[model samples]
Target: MSDGVATVHLVRSPARTVWTAIALSGAFLLAGCGSQADLAKVNHPRTVVPAKVVQKPQPNTPPRPVEPVFAPERLRAVDPCALMDTQTLSAFGVPASSRAVALSDCGNYMKDGAGKRLSITLRLGQNVLISDTAKTTKLAGLTTVESTSTTTCFVKSVVQEGSVVLGIVAQVDYEGDSCDVGRRLNESAINRIRTNAPLRPQGNKGSLTSVDPCAIFSPVTATEVLGGTPSMTPYDLYRCNWRRDSLSFGIEFAENTDPKNSSANKKAEVVTIEGVTAYQRKDDSFGNSCKIEWLHKATTDGKGEVATVSVDNTKKGVDIDLCAKATTVAKALVPKLPKP
Candidate 1:
């Protein structure tokens, strides 16, 4: 799905995993911890390379004449976590999670409980105009191209005046109906876009969309969770990591990233706190770490506010309670998010 340009699949723990390419190229985003994109052979070389989102959204702006009403470049400046909303992905089981976004692409590494993983990537592009003469059936007025593998299904649908392409992928980690899973996501995204709404509602000061992810966590909170003074890992605005050796932990905030893509296909459950919703994404991808993503606060742009509290015990030596601990930190976070 967006692994830099493709979503990389990790068969190892978050710390030792390598981000081997799966699909798309806006490169996607880094998986696990600190690793770059590495080339891996894939069956489909025809997959589209994702582009970047907008540089920023200037509120009350006029639509560009030459570009599509909703410019994919506009996504570059926006939050990748906001691309797909939770409502669109609920069919996948887990309703909330995190993601890495780019100007024209977004994606997540989704693992089912059985040790199978499906990496889904979304890409935005423009293509030639189409007529009813096309072979594919018209769904929500967009032209679509769909393909399927033994365990994966891909659908590339046209949105925004029938020229903007929305490329979506659903891969099963251990062999399920990835095609059906993907089709659901693909259809939901198209329906939402048709609403033609702005990304975020205007003048909501409680919104965490622009807050520095590092600032969201305090040292006191860090001590309460990871047992050490926390330091920034200097990755990106949406992600924050503690640099100390006591334990590797941090809060990763995503504007539009949907947890449904990152949540476990099975054994993933929905938990509500203070009337706010989030997903506890537990994956054996790395036996030593776990992620708890709060899929709370819906964005005006059709995505939602997601906060992922994660832990990596690869270096900590101590085997701690990942979910109980993550939920503990999440409790402190719900109060800080945007609310009605």
Candidate 2:
């Protein structure tokens, strides 16, 4: 100690200065053992810490893809009606006659003596993913749902392993339980699958799945038949209506029923359209003035593809007015049909 004024000291070391500069640069930082720091003396020391190393992050993995439910090759030739056994259909009041709509779908009208009825339509493989809400069922290792909206109800079963979806659509107009009807339809179809029913009976070539009735004619020919570019409403793969102004007509392919047996009620005559024999029948049953049926594909009992051309000439008698136009349309359509 000196006087009350105080004392001053200054010291500079090359080693200390170089070390301080290195520490400030911070090229490497780590924890180390240290004691104290004396500012007045040359005993200042720095605190040290362990080296902190950081690593760059990696990207996350992608999710696995969903497996497909079915194989295209195995199902390409399947007939929708083949899925339902005849016994099952008869149990549900399905007549020997089931209405075909396209290749893999058909309906049996549960009709009363009167014209009123509910329809149970069976479809194969049209829908893959169906969400179940109000009703669901498990049958034959498949998930089924009974989904209804006001007028119609559908019960669908998903066979995931086989990648096949069997659907049963029914109207609520029938007696007894609606779901029961749908379940019956689905169970019958599933049972047929278990037994491995043939895609089609032997010697049966299959349906005319390739026919587009509305597009069978040229624009010029259609204009002549329809009187203009016909407003077309297609009802699946088998039927379509072409309408223009006061004239309306439809083209349809009927399977399993021969027009020969069906022509009893109507005045019928065999007419030639494009060299193929077709029956021309006049009946107002469906407001169809003229109906001309020709063969398309075949089944049995003279049963096969019965293509029909129907025209609406409500006021005109069936003589030449409706029949002439009907014949014209039929002739144009015959050449475009897929081979039986």
Candidate 3:
């Protein structure tokens, strides 16, 4: 751990030189004691020798502190749908529907004069990705990257950069030149985020926007289901995942239609956990995984906000019942959620 060097200086023959000086002084004294004539014959001259200076070792320098990244709590508080308001949507075309897909993503769907579908999406606090072919620019004083495909164009402004990068993105899907719309929307979003990004509805006590998904279950519960201590990873405040060996578990909160009416879950088994109706889906398309979802509350747009518990057992030849394990986690999760 020592990152410094100590310097030492040594004079050659210093002990011998000191002894020779002492012997010469003693001989002069003895000769002086014998007679005054001898004292006069002995002549001694003073000589000065300079000592080498040794520098003290310096202490190790402390490591530099890491600079804090940009994390806007206000961005998390604002509703995703609020970014694409009536005026903003009308600028492009007549708006058909606007809805939140996730906690931080929203879509404003419109129709072109030829009846082709056009859409604008605003995404906040999202994971950043830039490809080699992507073009770079600046928006609202932040570094922005723009990527285009055959049908879609995306412009994202970097909000934080380091081990993990996060950004705010504006996406446009159109057959024509989509980057123009994307750039315009990105600028508008960045300005709104700076000055006046509309916030979520106030005083909704049952909302899960402020909850941390990783804190929902106890350690004992995690260990029991994962078969050991698991690594907990949070994709965001509303979603968390766990993994230990071949066993994996996850919990998520999102905006979705009701479980009973959702097309994706039409074949899902209807069940009840913690006295609330829930739908269970067993998917073997990739591995043995079971997902249980239940409605937490209804939003103002008639769509239900829901929570999910997913358990996957990928170990070969293991006789674990995935659905039962998913149910157990859901049972513990239901009581922790805020009641509507």
Candidate 4:
């Protein structure tokens, strides 16, 4: 038989080549365990996984309102004057010897226009009097005076008027005194000579009106209460009067230099009277000077209770004295006013 069919075909071809080499060694051990499980997931060890949460967007915002410290006519011209002299010594009437009574004005020889002519003399000693004119009061323009001396009675009055150019003489020295102490020192020197009167002409039709009762108490204006710079031509200072027990005020008259230019312009004339308002100021820093200021307020029966007085002109040289710095500028304007 041809070698028995070639030994069966070489034993089935060596069992089919050992079953194809065990199926190619189980497919190369399943492809090397699938590449070592992808190389253990590419060399493992990573784990961390917690990041994913975002939310942002916010911005916008707006809200703010609120609004008196003095001016009611300066609290109605406050001039309490120690409560008006303790209510005018408990209602009307004073001067029981008038023990130490004082009320003054003249603020050191007025000055504002430079007309310079001031002489205020009042002596009660050797009895020398002069001043009553219009031919000694025949009554034409009225310059009355009476008292031809009984024991020591002399009376004189000469007023040049406006800004005041006064000369008053009053004497009563009956050697034994007492006509109520010569009428309480002639009613305290005629109430300090009517607080330096002068400034009438209102209805007299002479045409001099004037106003400035401290600007009716304080709020000033009228050229800051007429301080300076008006050589005339209607500059008009101030004047006032209500009347009853008599009241008159005036200002505007300052000028008198050459004491070497008033001592090289250290000039002085500063008056600041509060209450009834009186402030006349002029300064040269204190060299050659002449100043005056007077301030007064009164009440006896006008309503009863109120009195204040102030006068100045530094040492009475240029001629206005009754100072205490006008009661220290009227107690510093009664605490800057504004309180009844």
Candidate 5:
């Protein structure tokens, strides 16, 4: 949405002179047959061709649709750190640190004069659930949902509302009334996104943000694994859920420690998936489920860009090997992911 406007502004500024110069240059020409000779004038009438006029579309003439400010495809390229930088946060407190918490999130930490901690988190494609107590207001020409707890405040503005709903969220945690701080941060974040927000590096060949989680697993693959046709639902751009009667499958791409070395796993069973070393674990504590995880690549600071697949048959009465089912889905998924 913002890119289209930038392009139009660029063309309008310098393109007018180019077209006008072409038209005027063709209308007249100087010719001299000899030194100190008088200029020759054609007796015949000369026609001057005017530059083509570019007209802006009128309101009543099938108005051009305004694209959503933040759509899924566009959000994938947004850099979270650029949305809320040190300069943008300097007003609240001394900007202490800023780091990327996730692909779509950046967390900023600061300290007030009294040495109290203050934080603001900016996220793209944030999933926000509006409760009855939450109030709605307009921020940057978009409907914003505001809610607060004792120490934290949440402000969310929907960027795209439809089957796959998405929003931009600004959360603040402060010692004082966080709502006031949240309001200012939210407004600044929105304005930056609409105007001069930075973007991810172009042509990131193997970035998972460009992949669609829903397209990774097909309906036929779900049916073959679950023994019944499954309904596919995407939680966000990075996660998808497929459910049958008593069986379910899920896949997600997110940040984590190396699955083989993660302490959360009771025992990491070494396994190989599509030539990639992986780990599988069975967890009966929560339900009859098994998970298979592998490191897609190292992102930053010992964090692994990982893909995890889970199979749950807790609802089924019979003793079905959940690990085998998880392996099947993992095999189908690993081959499709782009190599880092």
Candidate 6:
């Protein structure tokens, strides 16, 4: 050993060796814990910054109000001639051929205050077949016109195969010099004629009234005596066909007859102007007089079988007096047969 220096020797034992290792680990663990605590404290003292706010951009102005694209005035001014031509061609069922003729233009037609126009055209075949073309400016007032002016053109070739007679007549009227208005009027008139023409029959064979005077006779001109337009009212005339074997009977009366006043009732009476004998009978139920007529004829021509009755009306035309004055003039006038 050297002077002032001490030399210590460590003895190796199992227990002491283990204890020494544990102490070294504990010290290292304590140092690590101390470092984590100091770091946490230091971070807690620092201030935190808030995130920035970003705003969305606003639209500069509200969207402008949308306007309707179509106006009624603009529609009214649109050229209708093209539309008319298209419709007419469609109706003809054929392409515009040289044989087809254009009678009038839109210029000569008239326009109403609403700027509506009318135009007309007529096409005919070799057999007098007629086809009418009407062009209208306004769709609303097409049916207002009574008549129209139409152009007539004859087709060199026959379009249809049938026995038909076609004739067209047109009358055009205009407020001004617009052909468009005239065309529309013509179209309306033609359409009406076409609809109404089909209703008229050439003969009265299947109709309610008899056309042959020998088959039937009108006691009086029912149409004239009735005194009203047939088109406006329901009053109509019908001929009663005569049958020698069957008895012909009818009931007639005044329109407004009052039974309380016999004089008024007498004034309003129905008389047979021709064909048969008539008489008035008082009906107790309605206090009215009912006029009835019956004709029984054995002869075929009804020469001696005819009778005439007259009805006289009061000054006011309210009361009528029906009298049955039978005359044998028809019988006397009938030709006598030669001795057998």
RMSD, every candidate, angstroms: 15.6, 34.2, 30.7, 54.9, 19.8, 50.9
Candidate 2 structure quality by residue, lDDT tens digits, 1-340: 0111110111112111000000000000011212111112122122222212111111132211112322222233445554333434454454445545535555565653343455556654333234322234454444555555544555555432222222223223354444566665555455544444335434544356545555665667767986757655433234566666556667765454676666452568988788887788776553436777866666666677678787774333444477888888887787777666
lDDT of 5 by residue, 1-340 (tens): 0111101110111121000010000000011111111112222222322212111222234311124546566566666666455555666667766777766667777876577888777666654444434446666666566666668777666565444344566777888756666666666666655655456767666767666677767678889898766766554456676777667778877766877678865577989999999888887664577888888988776787788887776453679888898899989988889988
lDDT of 1 by residue, 1-340 (tens): 2222222122233333212223431112221232222212222223322222211112234223133433443332333344343433333444335454432345656554454565555443322222223234333344454545455555545433221222333333226766555555545444433343224334755555455555656668767876756544422234456644535666755555566655252456677766666666565454566667765556544556666777656544576777776777778766765563
Model 4 misplaced stretches (Cα beyond 4 Å): 1-101, 105-146, 149-152, 157-160, 163-166, 175-216, 219-333, 336-340
Q: Candidate order by TM-score, highest to lowest?
A: 5, 3, 2, 1, 4, 6
lDDT winner between candidates 1 and 5: 5
Whole-model lDDT, model 5? 0.60
Candidate 3 stretches greater than 4 Å from native: 1-73, 90-97, 111-117, 132-135, 160-164, 300-302
Backbone clash pairs for candidate 3 read none
Question: What's the ranking of the predictions by lDDT, best on top?
Answer: 3, 5, 2, 1, 4, 6
Query: TM-score of predicted model 5?
Result: 0.75
lDDT of 4 by residue, 233-333 (tens): 11112211111111111222111222222332244344344434333333323212222332222223222112222221222234322233334334443
Candidate 1 lands at a TM-score of 0.42
lDDT of 1 at 307: 69
Error of 2 at 10 (Å): 99
lDDT of 6: 0.21
Best-matching candidate per TM-score: 5
Q: For residues 154-225, write the lDDT of model 3, one tens digit per residue.
A: 776666554334567777788755666666666666665555545676887788775667776777888888
TM-score of every candidate relative to the true structure: 0.42, 0.49, 0.70, 0.19, 0.75, 0.17
